[model samples]
Target: MSGLRVIPTRRRGQDLLYVCGTDGRNVAWYDREAARVHLFSEDLRQDVLDALGPFLAGAVTVGPPPVPTAAELVRLALHPDDDLAPNRPGEALLIALDRDPGPAHRLRTDPRRRELAAEQTVGEALDGLEGGGWRTLHSIPLPGGDRVHHLVIGPGGLFAMYALAARRQRVVVTDPLVTTGRREPWPLLRRVRSDAARASYALTAEVRPALVLVEPARLDVTGPPREVRVLTPADVPALARLGGVLKPADVEALYAVARDRRTWGKG
Candidate 1:
């Protein structure tokens, strides 16, 4: 995973934590004074959680839990259908769950849990920009049933941001195609396409799509894969800077339309 840099800045008289991903992406400008830590991931061990709270350059507040998936909920309910029989889709998970449910649940939800941590980390940074010429609407439910982790409007143009915690993995990006270290590519790319269409239609405008691959071991990006920008969490700060400072009125109008959950689907 890429590292983070906490650059200090003051916006509108608010002491802010301007955090950046390794790739110089604009992660968020957090309100150092107002952000209360809320640990959102169970996958993170207590020790890790304890250390993570200092990002605001202070104590970390164990925040609420992260958003979960259908599989997660099913597993949590111990639904019989969630069984992990060998040779099936989640055979290993099933077996592990059978042998011992605790470890298995942790393993299965680890990736998603990391995603939550990333979102929460970034979300706190974003709070400072909430009314300071930037606006964000997160966990937007789409007609396709998947959610957009963050839909942002600011001095920069519109953006559809996705967060994935695929650390220690390699991803090869080529236009119209992507090959990951594990070689599984469909789900990630497919979601990017769907998100682009949803955001575009909802705002009646083109929305740039970006993927924030958490801390990948290596990313060999030859070109924009399928017109989507593959980025690391560290690149968030720069990504935000790319907007070149759009007008406040435009930002407000975009936020108003984009905030309407229905606009996302109708478009």
Candidate 2:
């Protein structure tokens, strides 16, 4: 007996079957996307193949893993703490709330919870575009205690997006100001553009600005806000239809840089 077992795992949306020895050490892995069985040790090649025999489909190249791409190398070099790729939709807010949850029984709802819902709703929509060759980083911290709610990179190019919790409220957009229900108008669009500009400077790429309103009952716009695209969660998927701005490699490269916490420090 080979004393080897096949373990399945998923990484970056791809399935991988790892061949492990009795000691639980990975000797090889079968990559379905690449159609290759990568061997860590030439001596165990046959044993690893035998272990993965049942899982193997079609013809697959058998050899050492291919060389890592530039993006892969960058990702591999990142420290886990400094990698922002895994941040959840409302990561910073989640951390803040966890640190000081405040009164367990509140008289009124916490506004942060509303904002968290907006971000998570929008974040999930953006995450769904991954299969179309897009990447999203949530809650990217900028300098001076400010942050970009989400950064999207794909064939449509880069976008620094802000999430607004409008929930059942009517929204009115007048130039720089945004009014939600009866609340006083705020220059939210200005801030959105500024965040995108700062991100552009940091990444040395043109990043468009977007304001995403979550489940607003109605929306009124006096005129199209200059340099900012206002959208709803439903509009996010259409962005995947855009192309010609960046290739797959460029998207991966930009995503690699954007996912590093240090990249935003410059902004």
Candidate 3:
């Protein structure tokens, strides 16, 4: 009972258990002390566990799910924000990395966070991009089950960005791709093409994709793919300030499609 305490997840009335097993620490469904660990986002689960430990000691156990209660359990099962609304699938990815880390997922809690952090910084830079001029959506999912890091739209057309946090690491941008000194060349342009096509469908507008190689230090590009622009995190704000404009209808249409929770997947 000590390690398997009944607890409320971020959402109220949606209770799971904090578990300690020989294999590792996790959150799972409990029935008669049985554990069914629902795998979604490991980083999120760990954050929940870290935060839950203190909050649960004094917080209210339940307040019922949100309105349109029919979707309450569905929403909970998929993992929701504190207010019972859906969260980005990438968030769940970070959490899942915490639960069962493979070589790739293992770096999520650390280096990848810098990557995600760079995305966050760009968000701050784009703070003035909203309201009739430009709209951006983060962590967009493709039909093929891949997710785009950032989607931006304006009069200049659409842009989808895939970002990596290199943190001052040595990186070489070879036009259509990137090869780090410490890592293999990442074929980000391929993803850009695929995601741009997907965005064109989602937004009904042709999208140009960009590969953002974020590092705290130096970044340079040599004849990168014509369609995909390679740039550093610092260069984002200027790009964002391009002042492209979209028709009201086009704006609403793309925003609606990108903002839909159904497009985010279960995380």
Candidate 4:
């Protein structure tokens, strides 16, 4: 779309509250849940309020499922950096956010992605890996039957090799975002960082870098780290096509790693 925004959300009473904005306008409001996304337009708020009726009944949950420990979140957030490898889940979260420079965004609640990222399952997000290029490596589950899969790409987009896979399926090229940032309607994930002291100790770090094509449109709430877009199915094809192309050596390497069961471990 023209411009987008994201707000971390939560329900109050029966309505939804979020921070929203477009290229030319923005605001934080507690409106009917439907109004948060479906109700507004560039012009008057007339249909905006009316459009919110259907979504007014419940509240929107914010963020992914909470991890067991703050440290665990730190690990997932800091993972997959160029200099460091995510060796152990227990030790991973100890890394500071500022260490890695790649952009990081969390997946929102949608049935399809949730289905793809089976909550608490080992291989919930394996679908992205089976194809030919970068595929899925791991998945994080949510309250609903949704999941968030992690992908990695090496080299560069047009000329690099990469890997993708569902959490359960053998890593394949079916889901490729590791190299080419081609997914459309992709969610806007906020970046997390850490101070220098922590960064030195963790040996893991990251920055809130923006994706190649994914841009933040608006804010969903008022807070330190913010929430961005909610992804929908409308974006699948572009992402798929971009991932399917076999042009980069990184993509080839990712495919090679995925095809070998010995490399994927139990997953």
On lDDT, the leading prediction is 2
* Candidate 3 lDDT, 89-177, residue by residue in tens: 24535655578565664634665566557666655554446653677776665555677777777655568877766776777777557
True-vs-predicted CA distance for residue 195, candidate 3, Å: 1.5
Positional deviation of residue 17's Cα in model 1 after best superposition, in angstroms: 44
Give candidate 1's TM-score: 0.54
User: Judged by lDDT against the true structure, how good is candidate 3?
Assistant: 0.54
For candidate 4, write residues 179-239 as lDDT tens digits: 2233342222321111111111111111111112222232122232222212222232234
Question: Model 3 Cα displacement at 149 (Å)?
Answer: 0.6
Write the residue-wise lDDT of candidate 2 on 1-267 in tens digits. 368988887754679887766644456788888899977567887888787888888898998545448666555568889899999999999999999888989998899999999999999999999999999999999999999999999998889999999989999999999999999999999899889877875664568899999999999999999879999999999999999777787787778778888877767
TM-score of each: 0.54, 0.73, 0.56, 0.23
List RMSD in Å for every model shown. 20.0, 17.7, 18.1, 20.3
Residue 186's lDDT within candidate 1 is 52
Better of 2 and 4 by lDDT: 2
Candidate 1's error at 162, in angstroms? Answer: 1.6
In model 4, the runs with Cα more than 4 Å from the true position are 1-129, 139-149, 152-188, 192-230, 243-248, 254-267
Model 4 — which ten-residue stretch has the worst lDDT?
A: 199-208
lDDT of 2: 0.86
What's the ranking of the predictions by TM-score, best on top? 2, 3, 1, 4
Stretches of candidate 2 off by over 4 Å are: 1-76
Better of 2 and 4 by TM-score: 2
